[model samples]
Target: MKTKITNLQPGMIVGEDIYNLKNSLNLKKGQKLDRDMIDLILKSDITEIEIMDSNASIGFIQKTFEELPNIIDETIYNKWIDSISDLFHHFTKEEIYVSLNNITEEIYKSLNVKEYFVLNFINSFGNDSLTYHSLNTAIIVSIIAKKIEIPYIMYKQTVKFSLIHDIGYAMLDDRVINDFDSDDKNALIHNIVAYKKLQDLKATLNHEILESILYHHERYDGKGKFHLKGEKIPPLVRITQVADAYTSLTELGYTPYQALSWILKKCGFIFDPYYVGLLYEITGYYPTGTKVKLSDGSIGIVLRRNEIEFFPEVLVNNEPVKTGPDSNVYIKEVIE
Candidate 1:
């Protein structure tokens, strides 16, 4: 029978392994629940457990993309969500060639469609932070790659790198992987683990793709593990770093605008200046699909951006509101 962790009895048997946010097994099947074990589960942020029974269903990780769309462009967002989910699973299973086919289709579809990039990302966010990070990173990478004029092949490869760059977390200890800081020893160790696993998998890969995944955590200012600085880091790696950091910041209680602002501020110090500029150019301060309050106390959803980062066209009560210095109305605050 399914039971809450607080309601679990001392002798109840675990029906199946329970996984953490990283998809690592936290509790093994058939383990008997005790007060101490229950205490551990509570501290781990886990809330539910299954008691063994003939009628009880085994637990499994549900796909994040299995849902109806909620954005302005539902069709395109749905395709991107499914493609990211498919690409993520393909890389997790080490099916590199198959993932290429899926990514190619995603890039091709995204070429003519320019408006849904941020909306697609926001729609794909879920409870699984790792999966959300991977998907959002991939989408943002693809968008920035196009603006930087990277060729189709390299673009596809970069998306793949973003999707599986953190796969090493699964191999590391759950305690360390959940911490979310590169200063932690386990974080750097996972980067090496992920790189070595890619090589050991025997999957055909470009040398640069492997390098990018291996060094995605490296800082542009020679501050990271290998102390590689500036041009020493691969351009794709730098791009991936910006995207990865953006996703991490957004997941850690930073609003989209706040996260972008943080990334811009860290430019040249932590991230590559050129790529950070590209991120600002792509997502802007007021990204599409977000609501903001005007100086006149009006609410609106951002529709599109212009040359000015703060000035964007917004839909206010189903009417278009132009905001900039020239107009009396300007964005006062972003609606959280």
Candidate 2:
């Protein structure tokens, strides 16, 4: 029962617990795969398959987790980064691409727009980094917007800007971005550096999108390194700036619930309370892939949840468990 998400190609047998997508839907599991299901998942935004094959049992993830605390070790960080970048490159190459077109809409039909949005972020991020800091940042923005119940399309645009937010990185060497710089000119480096590189991608970036990325680091206190702070800040720039900061935290290991708690406590100091609340609503108490312990002493991974509610579609004991007609299990604790 190997339950690690790694390289997944077609023709792979899958009967064990696994995540799948149907028209931009989030990952679901335990469903046997025929050719059509296989093709549909392949075409969706599924970046990783936690289950190896159908013959394997679902409880493998927990057994593996208890034995090996880190199924994904240090080497996994780079692998995840690469996987993310490649996913964006693959989809954005041709069309705007929609991960789940409408099935999720049916699942959460009664949920508020914000909850729907948080689901969207979890579903979207299920793919690899694709654009690293940028795409992840976009996801954070989407999450925040969902929390606040902003229109899905508006936040979706925010995500678009985020995905290509640093598309310019495509043109530069690791030295320019993945390194630290002196405070003086370094303040201006992040965006200017990225903006300059985007020029080479042949992308059709507009002023707003470019400016958002260009000024993502600026603040409203007028003390930002780039110094384009205060009212001089554009709305999108301010939005992306905080979204980027918050997303960085999640990427570093904070759960969406933990992050939302911190944001609520620190809002108005390091971040705007209005937007902070918005982001809090976007991530929900849990997002997909978050591992939790059930009251019965078994553990599961959260796969889906609305921003407003606290429960999610989780895989208990590594076996896929849905919160639908068959089960009545509730979460006990998250595997921090």
List TM-scores for all candidates, in order. Answer: 0.68, 0.49
- Per-residue accuracy of model 2 over 147-189 as CA lDDT, tens digit each: 5555765655565566555554343322122111113233346
Candidate 1's error at 167, in angstroms?
1.9
Once superposed on the true structure, which residue ranges of model 1 sit more than 4 Å away at CA? Answer: 1-96, 111-127, 173-181, 289-291, 318-320, 325-328, 333-336
Expressed as tens digits, the lDDT of each residue in 195-245 for candidate 1 is 786785545666777787778777777888788899899877888878787
- Those runs of model 2 whose alpha carbons end farther than 4 Å from true positions after fitting are 1-133, 139-157, 175-188, 196-204, 220-222, 227-232, 253-266, 319-330
Candidate 2 residue 261 Cα shift, in angstroms, is 5.1
What TM-score quantifies how close candidate 2 is to the native fold?
0.49
Q: List the residue pairs that clash in candidate 1.
A: none
Worst 10 residues of 1 by lDDT: 63-72
